[model samples]
Target: MIRAVAFDIGETLVCDDRHWSSWADWLGVPRHTLSALVGAMVAQGRDNAEAIRLLRPGIDLAAEYEAREIAGRGERLEESDLYPDVRPALTALHDLGLRVLVAGNQTVRAAQLLRELNLPAEAIATSGEWRTAKPAPAFFARVVELSGVAPHQIVYVGDHPANDIIPAKAAGMHAALIRRGPWGYLWADDPVGAAADWRIDSLAELPALLEQHRGEAG
Candidate 1:
């Protein structure tokens, strides 16, 4: 049985692409152009705003970026308001007697966002407390230890491949990828290509997906 179901917060349970789009607007660049540039900078381990500040003279772009992110908190509260179906889905999982947890790389700001969005804190398992982030085996290991579940008994779902699915799988957990966002090229948009054990587009689908593995040979 899938004893525990874990999730990633950013872009998986919460939406962040809108924040990026808002940031692009703040930078006064075409959405697609900004998206591409941001992707490149993130790929190169560079700061998108710093890169913009260096090249785009006289633009106190960092403040704009901060404003966009602050707006993301509001948006997460407004838009990511826990999809209409998410509550029922999670309730169903609870009904089935499976433990639910959130395991993700979240900044301190994100914790505030989750609160603003009214995401339940009961099941949350985060890396911020440990100063670690996903794609790091230590993060996944920490999640395992915190949840008190053996790796094979847990099912991890997230929108990022390398950060969530890949490491979870390596840690002996079944992983599912939820495709979201254009930032952090953790996985291609193509869910199948991500090679996750499973994929779903929305959190509403999670209960059924987890049920599928209850009797399967993992």
Candidate 2:
């Protein structure tokens, strides 16, 4: 029985385009330049951080990421930052008596962002807080721990096939791939994504999916 739902924040609940574009503006680069680099890296099945290093050789990636996070904090995320379907889906799940958690490979401020946005989640867990990032099994384990549910009883929904779906399934959680974010539409046909228990175009479909799961579990 699925008793919990854990969502990934970046590109899952919130589109990260604004954050990336803001970083580009702050760094004095054309928005498309940053977009192109990250897109090229994703296309080649490479890490986006590789593009950051390629654009400015010898730049400190961690320090730069942190700097970007700090600058964005001056004007934190708002409800407008979330996907339209996010609150609806999260609310529906909670109303169904399921625990809902929002987890992400993000700075600690991400938790604060969700809190400020009034997202419908029991808890917000960040990679920074856990000190482990996704695509790592331990990260999923921590998600399971925070959810207060066993892996098999949790459903993890996200956009990244490599970072979200694959690892969640490996950790024994059902994976749902939503085809909206950077990797989502591109990876729809990926073997790992296809292997997911559910693949939908939007979180608008999530409530029905949860009902179906509950039906079978019942």
Candidate 3:
């Protein structure tokens, strides 16, 4: 049976387009430019922050994150920031006695924002805090460690075919592909997605997925 459920925060639980647009404004580039940079970064198989560093050599990422965290602390995240299916799905999973957690490639400030949202996660962590990002085995390993279960007993859900699904599977965790975001739809047809344990359009579909998997495993 699946004992734990882990998620990628961006585009999975929360829509990150607004944050990317804000980054565009901060970088003094048109929002479309930032959006293009994101697509380019994904197309080239590069990390977003690394792409920014290469694209704009003088931008201070750390300082920008600090400013975001400061503003985030004072602001309350609205329900609109979350996917419509998130709360109900999380509640269903939690009531099913599964552990829920987030392992995301976000800034320290992002973690702070997550806490303020009162999500059903037992723990929410970011690469900035873990000092490693997804696609790195260490990040998935850490998630398994946090889950307190064997890798095979965990289901890791995310939008990125390469970063989230494939790597989680590589680490021996069952992977779920949620097709709702840039990476999700962008990477949908990748051969890697074919290896996912589940391909779902909404979090609302997850509870039944768990039941189906459990029955098959049983």
Candidate 4:
């Protein structure tokens, strides 16, 4: 039985792409510039410190981005109310007796993101706090341990296949890919190209999909 359901924040539960895009536009850089900065740092063998240094040009921009992101977050629910099915979908999973938690890449800002969205403070498990990011087995393992559930007993739903699906499965969890419409993890694997046990175009489809799994398990 599925005893718990873990989610990836950002693109999964709440949406922050608009804030990011606006930041990118304001900074006069490509939307993927931040992503490229991280990648360049890794490629140059500088680790996280170097990545931050490279992005120093936009230090002031960071505050503006954060302010807008936090202020505008959760203003309308999921992704500006564009995807109105999020709350209902989460409600259905909750009704199924599954423990819910969000594992996001925000590190220290994860909690802030949840708060901006008016999400319960306890629902988040962020990578920033742990000093690690997703797609790494250790990151997902931390959530499993925190949840007090075996990996196989949980379902991890995300919009990124690599960050969410592959690693979740590697940790022995069921994986589902949410078709994120332009509001996804910019630094992670593509949702469509990455492997997953199942893929759905909307959160509205999640309940029935889980029921199918329950049926099969039974």
Return the top candidate by lDDT.
2
Ranking by lDDT: 2, 3, 1, 4
Deviation from native of the Cα of residue 198 in model 1, angstroms: 1.1
Best by TM-score: 2
Every candidate's CA RMSD: 4.7, 1.7, 2.3, 5.8
- For candidate 1, write residues 132-181 as lDDT tens digits: 87788898888788668799888888766666777889999988777565
Q: What is the overall TM-score of model 2 with all chains considered together?
A: 0.94
Which residue pairs in candidate 1 collide?
A: none
lDDT of residue 12 for candidate 3: 95
Q: What is the C-alpha lDDT of each candidate?
A: 0.67, 0.86, 0.85, 0.66
lDDT of 3 by residue, 121-198 (tens): 798999989999888999998998899999999999999988898899999999999998777887777787777888
Question: Candidate 2: deviation at residue 193, Å?
Answer: 1.3
Instruction: Single out the weakest 10-residue window by summed lDDT for candidate 2.
Output: 67-76
lDDT of 2 by residue, 101-210 (tens): 99989877677777877777899989988899989898999999999889999999998898999999999999999998778988978896787789999887988888
User: Which pairs clash inside model 4?
Assistant: 107-128
Q: How do the predictions measure up, each by TM-score?
A: 0.72, 0.94, 0.90, 0.70
Output the lDDT of residue 168, model 3: 95
